[model samples]
Each structure stands twice: as C-alpha cells, then as structure tokens.
Target: MQTYNAPLRDMRFVLHELHGLDALTSLPYFADLNAETVDLVLEEASRIATEVLLPLNASGDAEGCIVENGVVRTPKGFREAYDVFRDGGWNALAGDPDYGGQGLPESVNKLVEEMICAANLSFGLYPGLTHGAVMALSAYGSSELKDLYLPKMIDGIWSGAMCLTESQCGTDLGLLRTRAVPQEDGSYLLTGSKIFISAGEHDLTENIIHLVLARLPDAPPGIKGISLFLAPKFLPKPDGSVGPRNGILCTGLEHKMGLKASATCQISFDDAQAWLVGAPHKGMQSMFVMMNEERLGVGIQGLGVASAAYQSAVSYAKDRLQGRSLSGTKRPDLAADPIIVHPDVRRMLMTMRTTAEGCRAVGIWVAQAVDLSKHANTEGERKEAADFVALMTPVVKALFTDLGFEAASLGVQVYGGHGYIREHGVEQYVRDARIAMLYEGTNGIQALDLVGRKMPAHMGRYLRRLFHPISNFIEAHRKHEAVAGMVEQLERAFGALQLATGQIAQAGLKDPEEAGAAATDYLRLLGLVAMGYMFVRSAVIASERLAGNTDEPEFYRAKLASARFFIDRTLPQATALFLAIKSGKASMMALEEAAF
Candidate 1:
C-alpha cells in the first residue's frame, strides 16, 4: 500500500559486513557502540522514518515555508514531526554527550541521517542545522557561550542558524559587504543582510542561535577582514532565560523549486548584538567548521534523496505490469508481467541500487574517518584521518551530489509518465537533489579547491594520506577474479590523480589556468574511483559474509550483487575520465578569448 522507504538492509550490510562494527568498540571512544546497540538504534530510526517523516514529505513540498511579521512557519506537519524527532533524541544522536548529545560515533549517526533524509528531507533540515549549530559551538564557543546555548540546542528547545551569504557573494566570501561593530560590553553590533540562510529563522524551537559572519569597521579588505559572531534570536539573560527579541530578523524567504518546506531566509540585522565566535579575522575558519560539516551533510542529502527516489521507483516497476518479460513471464493469468521482468527496468533499478549503496559505503567510511580524526590519541593518526576528510570532502560534496541528481533523473525515467506527475513525488527528488550541488560551495568551487588547495595541501600530505587506504584496498583485492576489473579501473584513476597532481604542480608553477581546467572533472573521476574501491570492498564483505554462518543470507547476497553491478557497470566510467585527465587541458585552453 505505502511506498518502500529507507534502505535499511543495505545500511546494515555496510555497517556490519563491509566494516567491523563489533571490533570498533575496542577503541575507547567507541567502546559503547557495539553491534547490538547499532542494530537497535537503526531499527528504531527506520520506524520513525517510515511512520512519522515519510507521511509529511509531499505535504511539505506542496505547502512550503511561510513567513509573516518576521516569524517563519514550516509546512503543515513539520513542527509536530520535529517535536517528535527532538523528543526522541534524534538531533543529538551524533552530537557531543557533554552537551546532552547521545555522543555516538559518526558511523552510528550517519545511518540515522540517511533514514531521516530519505523520509522527509525538509523535516530533517531543522534539526540538521541544529546539529551543525551545536557542532560549531562545541568546537569553538567560549564556556560562557557554550554553557548558555548548547543545552537548549541539544534539548531541541532551540535551533541554530548560520548567516554567511550576501546578495553579491555565494561562494566568494572575499566579496561580502556585511559589517559588525564592537561594543564596550564585550559584544559586537552586527548589521548585515544575508541570503539563502537555511533554518535562518524558524518557530520549531524557543530560540534560534545564529553564527553570523560580518566584517568589522577596521576589518581588512576581502575575506581576511571578516569575523564570526554568536548572535541568537533571543538574547540570553544572565540566568540563561530568553529575553526580548534581538535585532536579527528574517526579512524574506526564497521561493525555491524544491525543499520548499525547509525555510531559506533573507535576514537583515540592524546592529544586532553579537559576540565573537573565534579569533578575529578567523571568521571563515569558524563558519567553515559548520560548512564542512554541512557539505558532508549535503552529500548525505544527495544520498538520502537518491535512496528515496530509488526505493519508490523499485516498487513502481514491480507493480506496474505494463510490459512483458524478456524471458517471457509465466503470469498467464495477468494482462502483463511486472515491468521489473524487463531488462531495461532491471537496469534502472540496478543503477539506482548501485549508486545509492556505493554512496552509502563511501559516506560511512568518510564518517568513520571524521570520528577517528576527532578521537584518535596521536597527532599523526589524527592528521591521517583529517587529511582523508580534506581530500574527500569536496569529492563527496561534488561527485556524490552529481550522481545523486543523475540517480534522481534516472529514477523518474523508470516510472515513465507517472513519475513526471506531481502525485508520485519522483520529480521532487530531482528538485531536491539539484540544490545540493549548488549550495555550500558549488561543484565548480569544490573542484578548484581540490586541485588548487586540497591536492597541494601541506605539500602533498593530503593526497599521500588519501592514497594510503585506497592503495591498500587495491593491493589486497588486486587478485580477486570477480572484482579485479574494478580494482584495475580504480588503479588507473588513482594513478591519474597522481599524474594530474604532478602535472598541476608543474603547470600551476607556470600558469594557474591549467590547474583550473583539470579540476571539476578530475574531482568526478576521483569520486568515481573512490566509489569503485568501495564497490570492491562491498563485494569482499558480501562474499565473506555469505561464506560464513548468517541469518540474513538474502540481504548479504543482494549487497554482493549490488557491489558486482556497481563494479561491472559503473566503474568503467573512470576509464573515460582517466583518458581525459591524462590528456591535460590543451583543448580546453585552445579556445580564443573572443570565441564565446
């Protein structure tokens, strides 16, 4: 009757089979996250996703966010759903325990993130911002600020917002014109206009904590002049009670094509009382504290939307008996066999499955990398993990989202005419997936950052660290007959990254355009190869699990099948990218200045 929701089977496979969930608890920080606990947590999350959130998704799209007299209203059932969500401790599931969070490992949190987003992406945005807000404060806020805000935020009584954009600047912070002035009371007066602020202002919580970015009067030109501030919707009194409204107010809302239920705000502050978040002129660093986390979260959004579309399409294909089977269906009693019996239908479903499952594995690995980076005892170990995050963050954001949109489009194609209609909700997925690529630094900027900044960070330390695990995977799996083709493709792509790096290092020294031209597509290639390795890993896990005693045989088998589909069907694209990256910028740069 209802549409299928949340890829729980694949998620569990990634958690237990592809990775050693039971063994990870030996690490002190993760000692509490045993396999049983993980199962319990994920199972409950699945229920909420199917019951509470999924029902509200379409209505949220139809209603969108509403703004009146500086107060914002979420679509029909969002507040109630968010209240249930917060009461269930879902917002703080991946947060710091000292601030009232569950303090689970990033591995545990990502599963919850996937389910919630797949259910109602807009409903999740409210807490999603809160999670980032709490993370920012936990990482950089002073004791007074943390003491005053994180509890209420953690409790879901308050939400968090980050204001960093202006009319002239989206990704280029150097061009922003917002201003903040210091006061004698150890606070700053922030006056600026910020656009596209997600969860910028909402009624889901009693108060909203805004981490605002503005340039001070003495601030230097461009981004170096900027500063970060902790400005809340309601100024906190000495006793931590909400006071009268602060100067910060929502001026308007963006009427976007999708995720309409999640309020995107245009807020203007006329000398709002704001406190410095981190060191002066280090505002970009603090906001990035949230942005990097949000970037990964946006990638999760991509995965989430893809899963939603894919699940619905799978169900639709099975039930819509519009076509005959290639093998000739035996359903003589029916007018036609299920569309899924057709090869074309299988291709669509398999495409969605492989992309979604592969992305899930990559996201899980990246999340673990972040957790280890935070909790690892040694500086060198921490650096290794941080470097992985650095190299992968942009790739995760750009490539995953790109694939996400593509998957969404393919999902619509699966449903044919019914998918294009508003009632089926496939088009909403396409609309939702589109923004992920645009926000939190466009894919173009992500590519440039990869080539210009990430590739060369710390004199190649990031790339070196990134290649370690990838190289290990290739070396270990190089001989496997089933996935050797996949590994060979990955090796070529990995080698291309190395080759491109050397070329960029040489070319960047002479001219920057060569590096820029190679970036975006290079990131895609890198992402594809990285995911190809994940597919190989999944195949290993599935093969190993199926060999041993297992209660969930079918689940494990499908995972292996999906991994094979990914490797055999998807990984070869890296060959095209490998050829292109090796060719290197000559054709791209050959165009004359006036040719356009």
Candidate 2:
C-alpha cells in the first residue's frame, strides 16, 4: 500500500521557496506559521495518514457501507479513526479558535487536506463535506446559528453534507424542484428531494447539518428564486442539546462506481425546519463564497486521487519485474528486470511525479493566496492575491480532476493486468477519480467559467494576473542558465494563450460555440502553463536549497528533472490546443441538431 502523506519538503519549497510564505508568516494571522511549525503539522498529518486512514482504504472499498434499521454503517475502523482525527485537532486545523479550533493558516490546512485525502479519499469525504458546511455556516449564518453549530462542527463532533443536486438538476439551479416556503420567524419550510448528497447520512457524527438549496414559493423565476437553508438531521436546540430529528430523511443511497465507501444519498426534506443562510435572494452569493474552497476542494480531490494513484503506481513499477533493462539486464539472475529500467516506464513515473509536484506547488500557492487575500495589510496586495486565486480556482478544479482521472487511468496502464484487478487498488482509484470531474461544477462548466465569467472579471486582469508573476519569474531568473529554457517555454505557451484569447474573442462574438467547444481544451492548456510555471519555480527553489549542502540534494535534483520532463512532454499539448482554437468553431458546428 502507498502512503498519502503530504511531501513536506516539496510543500515547503512551494511555499517559502516559491510562493513567499514568509510574507504571510510575518502577518498577525499567520505569525506562528514558520517552516518549522508547518513541518511539524505535516509530520503529524503524515502520521495520521500512515496510521489511521490508509488501512481502511481497501477494506472500505470491499466492505463498502450497508444501510439497515435507518442507519448507515461505515466500514470497520472508520469511527475509531475519525475519533483520532478529531482528538488530534486535525479537523480544525484552519478553523477559527473561538470554537475550540486550532486556528492555523489555511495554507497548512490545505497540505493536511492533501495528505488526508490521499490516504483514503473515500473516508476523507465525510469530514471534507463537514468542513464545507462549517465554512458556509460560519461565513453566512447568523450568530444564533453559529453558536448552535460551529463548536460541534469545528470540534469534529458533528459532520455535514451539501444538498444541491436533484434528479432533474445538477448545476442548473433554475431547473431544481426543491422548494422552501418562508416561515413567519424568517426560517423556511424546506420540502424536496436532493440526490448525489455525499456524506448525507452516516454514523461518523452525532448530527448531520445539511446546507440545502431550494426555490421559494413566491420567489422570482429561475435562479433568482433559489435560496440556501440549514436543515440538520436533528435541529440544535437553544441549550445546545440536540432537538428532535428534523423532517429530513435519507431516502436511499446512490450505488456509485467510485467513492463507494462515501455514501451518496438521496435525501428527502418534508417541510423541514430550515434556517436561512444569508438573505434569500442573495443565497447564490453566499454559495459562491464557499465555492472557491469547494471548487479548490474538488481540485484537492484531484490532487488526492492523483497522488495516491501516482504514489501507488510508482511503488508497483519498482517492485514488479516484467522486462529486461534497456541498458541490457544487469539483473540477469532474474528472468526479467524491473519495469523502471525502461525509459518509457521512467517517463510514465516521471509524468505522475511531475504532475503531483506541480499540483502540490500550485495548490499551496493558491492556499497561500487565500490566506494573504484575507490578511494582507495593504489593499493592493490583498486584491492581487485575491485576484490570483479567483482566476486560478476554476482551472485548478477542472484541470486537476481531469488530469487526476487521466493519471489514474495511466497508473492502471502502468500496472498492466494487475492494475485492472480489484485487488491491486489502482482500478478503484480510477473509479473514484471519475466523479471528481463531474462534481464541483463539472469540468465543462469550470472551463466555461474560466473563459467566460472569470476570464473577463477584471477586463483582462486575470490574464495579467497570471502574466505579472510569469514576467517576474522570467526577469528574476533570466540569468540562471539551468532554467532559462524552461522560462522560454513558458513564454511560448503564454504567446499561445494570447493567440487563443484573440481567436476566441473574435469567434465567440460571431459564434459562442467557438469558445464553448474549445473551452475544455483551452482550460487544460492554461492549467498546463500555470502548473508548469509553478513546477519550474519550485525546481529553481529546490536547486537553490540544494546549493546549501543539504542532506537531501537528490530530492531537489529529482524535482528539477521532473520540471524538465513536464516541459519536454506536456507543454507541447498547449500548442496543438492553440491551433485547434484558431481553427475556429466550424468543426464544432459541422452539422446542425439533426445531423447525427
């Protein structure tokens, strides 16, 4: 089995070395978060991943969950493991301190999240959804709601779920049938069925808080009528004791292909006592506040799935002796040499490693941005960091998950026949990763948001937002002999992006599908460039760190080599994407609706 601990050295390199964590560490909010402290956190998280979570991964996959007597039974050891997670304060790493949370920076929390998810993504979804619910309630709920909920939630005593998808609607809220009738005291009576509600019903927590979205009776038509509500399994009373069970019930669970251990429930809310989250009409705004993390969380879902798949595949490749070495077998005593001896296997392993490194680097940078944007002293600095994260969130979610699924598939390929077998675990990973692309606003929607809403948010500020950092990196490292070619590659990719922008802007005006059809590929290209930049930056930092005569010179060297691998193999895809976008929407519009 593979360990899912965050690569602490790589995380630090991406943070202090590449993304400037020191600047935030000096801030009051992040004052205690230096490299040493951060490493301690990662080390502890690693211990949890190695000790608690990974063990149940295969067990949960095989045993899955069984629902009987109106209760869902988690796989063996999950309840006990969750207890350790709570006892260690892992659940509240970045939570506010007022509610018994440790109040660490989100940057640290993100690293921890990566580790936890990698260890056992199915198990991790329970708390991951809880964290999202907490964020929504903390940010948008009233004081009464916070006092009632935050402590238990932050303490990891109560878990949570998101109720958005229905049979008729997934992303299109306007088409949803979930209904909420306004009550006299400002609460609402929610009645509807929500499907695909992950962690919707479980034994892990005392109470499950559901953040449901529904349409009001006299509400304006479409999404404007949509509202957010807090409908718990059991309403929390004023004295903090659990009230009678609310009107919500778990109708059934979805037998998903992936994340089988994580229950995907179809919930029924029959005039449930629901508290409004934010104002009725502005629920979408409040939802968007959480989407950044949720989407990024989905990105982390990608990171988690990919890291596990890659790490496991790497181990498998090393131990599985299948073929003679390309250099003529030194292992002549054995029938065949390890697969890693071949350049192509080496290439596959390196691709996974490089992608993992890139995603970690970019995710950490995004995490740091989220922290700085919240705490930066100067408005300009705050806005810049905020813009950076906002621009990158959709790309991270779409690209990471898309690539994560692809990487899982590749891992299976690397394992040959064993990979396809359920016993090996790689096939399960592929199944688990498949859903991440569809959820969290779906990759297609994410791509459209990138090219449509987010791209134009600042009138090209987002593109400039990316370019400023690229320019700075280029100027700062132009003289460095090892990295100049990589920078030139990024420059070429950036030019490709520019031409893409021009071509799309022109064609989109004439035919919107021109942008729509190419949006998915275009987003991947941007993610490649963006992740490539982070990889190169990380490599540069790792090299500089190596110059200090460290005990781990090879680790840094490996990272630099991985960066080179991405440049050689991956960035060229962007060029093809650029030409495809330039080819216009004609291919996409080859025939009208009846052509098929």
Q: How high is the CA lDDT of each candidate model? A: 0.83, 0.83
TM-score of predicted structure 1: 0.96
Question: Highest TM-score: which candidate?
Answer: 2
Predicted candidate 1 versus true structure: per-residue lDDT over 10-92, tens digit per residue: 78777777766754576777777778888889999999999999998888899888899999998887788888888998887
Write candidate 2's Cα lDDT for 116-171 as tens digits.
Answer: 87888898888888887888888899998898889999888888788888899878
> Candidate 2: misplaced stretches above 4 Å?
1-6
